[model samples]
Structure formats: C-alpha cells, structure tokens
Target: MKIPITAFEKEPLKDHCGIVAAFSTDDYPFFETGLKGLRILQTRGYDGAGFCAITKFGKTKTYKGIGMVNEVFSDGKRKNFASFPAQQWVYQVRYGTQGIVNDANVQPVLLKHRDGDWFCVAHNGQFAKDRNKREEKLSDTVLFAQELARSREASWDERIVTLLQSKRGAWSLVIATKNGLYLARDPLGIRPLTYGHLIDKKSGELIFCVASETGALEQMGVTDFFEMLPGTIARYNDQGLHILHQDKPHQTALCVFENIYIQHGAGRAHLPRKGNRQINRSPTIDDVRRKSGKILAREAPIKKSDADIIIGVPGTGIEGGMSFARAVNIPYFQAITDIWDEPYEQRTFMSAKISDIYQKVLDHFHFDAASLKDRSVVLVDDSIVRGNITKGLVYLLKKFYNVHAVHLRILCPPIDKPCHLGVNTRSAKELIAARLSGNIEKISKALGANSLAFLSVSGLKEAMYTPKNKNGFCTGCMSGEQYPINEFGEPLAHRRKKATQIFLYDNVTNPAPILL
Candidate 1:
C-alpha cells in the first residue's frame, strides 16, 4: 500500500556538539559506559558520532562516522570494540557548526605528536578565528589537536593550557592520552562542562567521568559532581584528578542559549549567590523555560477570546508553551505531533540546503488540521533564528489548517547579533531580528503573524538566576554587545569598530549564508 505524504516547510537553530569521557583507576573497560553517556547527551548534537578508546597497554583505537551514536556504534561494532579491553574512553556527538560535515571532521580526533605519542580529543564548541590558508579544510577541533601534538610544551597538560590560553572561543574538551584523561573549559565559560566520580561496586575502584552536561553523569549513576570553573584545566590519572592550571579570574560569560534551547530539559546550572559567603543554587533548564513563558505572558498577555488555545512548537518549546497556557488561563493542546522516521529522524536545522530543511519539516512534523480548524492559536517557540520555520508554520496554519490567527510568542529576547561562542548562527544578516532592526511590528508582519512578542532580556535573566545572584550571561546575540573575549583571545571592549570588524569577517568568510 502506498501512503501520501504531505509536504510542509520549516527550519530551526542548530546546536554545536556534546562530549563524554571516562577514566578508571582499576583499568576497567569503559566502552559501554561511554556509549551510554553519549546517548544521554545526543540532543546537543546528531550530525555525527565517534569514540576513542585507550587500552591498559597504551594502545589506542578510534571509530567514527557521519551518523547518530547508535548508527555509528551499532551492536556488531560495539561488540568488536568491547573485545579490546580499554581503561579510558572518550566519545563525541557532533553538529558540525564549523568546517565540513564529513568523515574527516568527525571528532575524538586522534593525532600523533612529533615525539610519536598519540592523543585523541573530543570538543564541544567552535573557535572564533578562521583557519589559515594551509588548514582551510580542517575542522577547528582537528586543528586544535594538531596544534597540541606539535606544541613545544614539556608535557601534555602544559601544552593544553598554553594552547587554550592563546585561542579564542567556547570549548569544553575531553582529551585522552596514554598518560591520563585531560579536561578543559574556555576562559569565558561560554560552554558547560562537569566532572564526577563513581565507585565500582565490585572492585571499589574510582571511575572519573566528564561531559558537556550533567545529565550524562546522572545516566551513569553519578550523583556527586561539580561544574568545572571557567578557564580550568584538570587531569585524571593513576594518582587522581588534579587541577593542572586555572586561568586568571575574568568575567564569566556563560552562554544563555544553553538554557533557552541547546541544553536538554533535564540539564541544570548551578548559579552562584552573593552574600557574606557564596552559595550555589541549581535550576533545571525546564524550570527556566517555563518561567520564561510565565514572564512572557505577564509582559504580553493574549485574551482568551483572541487565542482559544496554545500550541508549543514541539520539543524545546513544549515546556514554555505549557506554562504560557496556564498563565493565560487558556487550554493547551498538542496540536503538532512529530512523525518519527525510525532510526533516521532528520533535524531541519542541521540541513545544509534550504530545500532539504523544508522537506525534513514536512517529513517530521504533522499538524492536526482538524483540531485547529477555525481556531485562534498562540504558537509558542524557543527563538526565531532566521524565521524560515516560524514563517512556514504560520503560513500553514492560516492557508492549510484554516486557523483564524496566530499570535507568536518567543521565549527569549530578539537575537540581533550572531553568536561568536559556539552556536551555528554565525552571521548577523541571517537573523530576522537583526535584519529587521529588532522592530517587533516588522518582524511580526514578516512572519505573517497577527502579533509577535519576545521575552525581554531582563525577564530571561530573571528566569535563569535569582535577583540577588551575581551570575553573568552572554547576551551578545540579543543585545549586540561585546562578548567577554574577542576573536584574538583578548578581552573585548565596547568599541563599535571591533564589532564592525567581526561583522565584516563573517560576511566575507561564512560558507552558509541564509537568503531570505
């Protein structure tokens, strides 16, 4: 029997990557544990997956492919890798925000030092600088690994610290070498990284694990964990985990988008409080999203008569939509359902071509035309990057679904600048908000919505941290402000000239420019 498939159009913002690493004192096999952790953090990336394993004898093996974790490390392949006993493991799921999305770019990138020692690194963020003419084809992570291998530093830990201190960008890296497992985060704290330990029940040996998110640690039954401070480099070896270097104190600029979209709902952040003594309070990403919705409702409330129901844009938007519906005293409905395509569910944002993105939207998302017929809908979504998907969904509701009206509510503030820290949106021209000068009315009209509103910058901060807390966030994309650091790994000043240089660089070098 043949089934007809309706075609629709949509797109989304893309995340960077996720990394996981494990080291055991007793030389226990950690291949399976690493795979499990990668699965838990797969939402951060899905374009490719790979892992590198180090045996007790210092022999290293690496496997990677351009697919999801399960597809790359299938049951048969897992068995093959498990046959080789390994004491240390590192895995990565990549979204390819930088360089080409091919086999060569896949991470857990293994490189040989000039001295003949081999090391593998899995990275979770993008570099701010462009590759030189010689290294144009290499991804940032691969180039980083090459540099580490060729460095003149006396030790691997010293090489990592020296290289990272000179580079600009948001990176959370897990490096595996014959000596030990090394983990590092960028000075700005623009990305997330956490490390934890679990005791083996039988051997009573300690196992150390590090990941871009805490959820992966939880999946491995690790309850006691600590978020790595910004600019810190640490290593886990036979002796134990030790801090190799900690960069001088700087203004922390954690990426706000992690709370808004990139991170999983279960992910949490430990916000530091200000008082006589510092105390950290944790808040789930889900809670922050829901609170953003509530704050949005207060800022721009839609009447019940105007909006009969609220529909979340699926996945990340669901939490915010539920809270928005409750705040407005309107009924919430799962009017949009995802049509899973077995093992190969396509992400529209990850598509390189606009045509492919639109096709994937039709293949993956199904709208309930019958339920939404002639009903006014308030569509809630995380953020509108290029506005292709938001515009397509709005047009479908009115033209095909026969919806009366669509009042679009975004959970975050209007993004008017490109993210230099790790997100895929690298050019400001591609951002609808940036194109429209952050004008609400114009953006709403462009999206074909009855009205549009975004949660304010202050509201977003309130939702993530306490009013009295001293936590800092990188709102450069929203406010067109200077990032904590510039592309040269120097502290950024509030100079318009520097901003202009960055904008010019992006326009000239960006390979994937969205055309409206």
Candidate 2:
C-alpha cells in the first residue's frame, strides 16, 4: 500500500492517541472510571478503544475493539466490564499512526515475557520514523513492550526509562504491572500527560487518575490535578505516588497541536516552573486558539477590499477565523455549515486518499451559495498540512458556487516537515508546504486561490505564549528543529507500509499478549 505522494499528497493530520491509568485504593468500579476517562479523551483518538484491568485477586482482564469508545464498549460490553472486580485499570483510545487498524493493532498492548512476567502498556505519542525501519512489523507501543520485556532492568521505572532513552520520539505513556502503575513523558514533552485525584470523603483516601488531558481526569470528577514535567516518571501504588525519576528537559517541546486542535479548551498546560516541578499558572486552550487568531491577523493582515467576507471552517477553525476577521476589519459570515445529520464527519484533509478526502469534505460541508455568490471570500482554516481540503474548498466556492474569488489564510505556520511526535503526518514528502518549496504563490496557484499567506512560526508562538513564557510549544514540523532524543537509523514510511503484516504477530498466537 505504498501511496504515491501525488495522489495522497494531502492526508488529514490526526491528534496523537490517548492513555489513562487509575490506581484505586478501594475495590470500586474502576473499569467504569477508566471508560469515563477514555470517553473524555475520545477526541484525541476515535479509531479504537480498549482497557486492561487487574483485580485484587491478581486476575487480569482486557477488552479491545476497533471503533469509538462507546462503539467498542457497548451496553452488553459495559455490563461485562462492570462484572470484573478490578482494583487497577489502564485504558487506551488509539489512532493508527504507524500500524494498520485491526483488533490486534488496537492497543493496551499486553505482552507476556519469557520469564513468566506480564506487562501491559498504552502509549500516546510516536517514536521517530527512523526508529521502526528495522522492525516494520511492530507498532511503536508493541515494539516498546517487546523491548521492555527484553530489558534487564529490575525496576519498572528503570525499564520504562530504558525504553524512553532507547527510542526517540514523542511518548507520553502509562505502563502497568500487577504491582504498580507507572507514567512517563518524553524528555521534550511533545505530548500532554497529567494526573489528578478524587479523595474518598469518608476515609479521606486518595484515588489517583492519570490521562492524556487534565479534562479527562475532570470528567471522572477529579478536581485537584497537576501536569507532569517532561522527562519524568511517576509511579502510583498502595504506598501512594512517588517521583521515581525526573530529568531536566533538554528543550521543552510541548506539541502545539494539542493546544490548537487536540486538547479541549478546559485543559490547563504550562511551561517548566522557575525552580520547581509545580507549574502554578496554566493557559487555557480557549485563550490560546483565540490569541493565535489575533496574532495571525496582526502578522498577515488582509488588505482592505482584498476580500469581501470571511468563511471560517467550523469548530476547529472558527475561533481563529473570527479573531482574524475582527483584526482585519472584514465582515465574517457563517457561510459553510456542517451537516449535523452526517455524524461521521471526517476531517477530510486527514484521509489517506485524495478522493476520500474530497468526498468527505463535500458531504460534511454545504455552501450557502445564495449569500456567497459573486463575492470575494477569505477562507480560514486552523492549519494546513496536505492542502487538499483548502484547495478543494477553493474549487468548490469559485468553480461550483461562482464566488468572485477565494483567498486562503492559515492560522499556523507552514508545516514543512513530518511530525515524529505521534501525529499522522509522519513524512515530509506528504506536506504541501514542503512539496511546494515553501513558495506561497505556487501553493496559491495549486490551491486555486487568488493569494495565500500563513502565520510565521514566531508569530504563532507569540499568539500562543503567555507574557511569562515566550517559547513553550513544539514547532518541530515547521522549523525542522530536531528534538534532543532522535535516534536515527530507520525509515518510517517503509515500516508503516509493512506494519500490518509484522506488528499483528500477537493477533495470530494470542488475541491478547502478555496476560499474566
């Protein structure tokens, strides 16, 4: 399934996967808590859902299926989940970044070591593309599991750190053993991971929950929580939480996409504190996306009369588009409407095939041709990776709807490189900005736009950054700046193509691996 860059030049960019691990002091219905946490994190991943639970009696149970969290955990399945007496739980919602979508590929990867020990893992980020070339058959999580099982380290935390140091990419992971639960983030912190607590009022006992987003913890009724520092590992057990290992971040490269599109507005993220691990003040995503819009306007203001009205793409693009319109003093209109009936509204740009993306875009959006007819329009989207939908939208407006002209504006800077941090766009060749040599006019011509401009990387940082911290986001895709821990030896595209055949090794022998 080697897709030529020309036909699939623009695939949709997807958020990284999601992970959750809960340590319960009492024999509460921990499975439901894990499911609720996964439900809140559904946005990060929708392709599949699964969970692994260990009961107080040392029995382990796991259920995984390909679909949305609710779809996978149906009413009957929920009842089954409830019947399991679990004391600790680990859950995962997966988006296939490097592996094919199948039952085995669906995660909460459980592996049984040759030594008769069992381990289960759920990961939220990606290893570097080059890291998997030699073993194209293994998914990053599965590969990490195999590597961990093979490691000689005696402690779970050391085994995890060994995996982190050996593999280079964005990994915010929760690795669970029957004994304790461990959480680790990559040194650069490209993916978000946080932990929160819900105290039992009766006994004042603490129940700790960890997830990809703080909002997921809050969904489970957690009130007090804190973000983890990059290059840190936290282990939770009967004794309570302990920071077993913490490393100084070589450079804090928190993935910007989380703030822009992945994370919900309510989640709080922060830069490293001045001298401590505690981050006192965190920025809300609502503020960051809106500020990005204002900065986009300031950086690339639309000329007067250059466009008659603004058409902001819904949900993800609207906030920035509205701010851009206001800053540019242009009339903003809700020209494009999403069809609520079409519940499967794939962000067309994220599709692997151009035809699928085009069809999805047409099905998802309907143009109000009567209002937009014969008027110049400015089209605003949050970010452009493949440029398929933007180009298609321009063609739809001008060619089909008879709009006077369409101008394209992007909120983020040009993505000229592949994201090695668990995002779906893992190859530089797939990026339109990279393909077009970063030439705006050529991109404009290709997209059939009258003109096009993008917010500069510095401008994007300015908009997203608080006055207190200027550079806290990962713009690795835009700047091609290597993160501190890239282990270069393999090719991602080659391995991704072969992933299905090799990575599903456990599916044949055991639907679930590493069952202790």
Judge candidate 1 against the unseen true structure and give its global Cα lDDT, from 0 to 1.
Answer: 0.75
Best by TM-score: 1
Residues 132-167, model 1: lDDT tens digits: 544357788888888888899888877887888788
- Lowest lDDT sum, 10 consecutive residues, model 1, at 500-509
Error of 2 at 19 (Å): 1.0
TM-score for model 2? Answer: 0.84
TM-score of 1: 0.87
User: Candidate 1 — which residues are off by over 4 angstroms?
Assistant: 1-12, 130-135, 270-281, 343-362, 468-471, 495-516
Q: Candidate 2 overall Cα lDDT vs. reference?
A: 0.71
Per-model TM against the reference: 0.87, 0.84
- The number of clashing residue pairs in each candidate reads 0, 7
The segments of candidate 2 whose C-alpha lies over 4 angstroms from its true place after superposition are 1-12, 113-115, 128-133, 153-158, 161-167, 200-205, 269-280, 341-359, 479-516
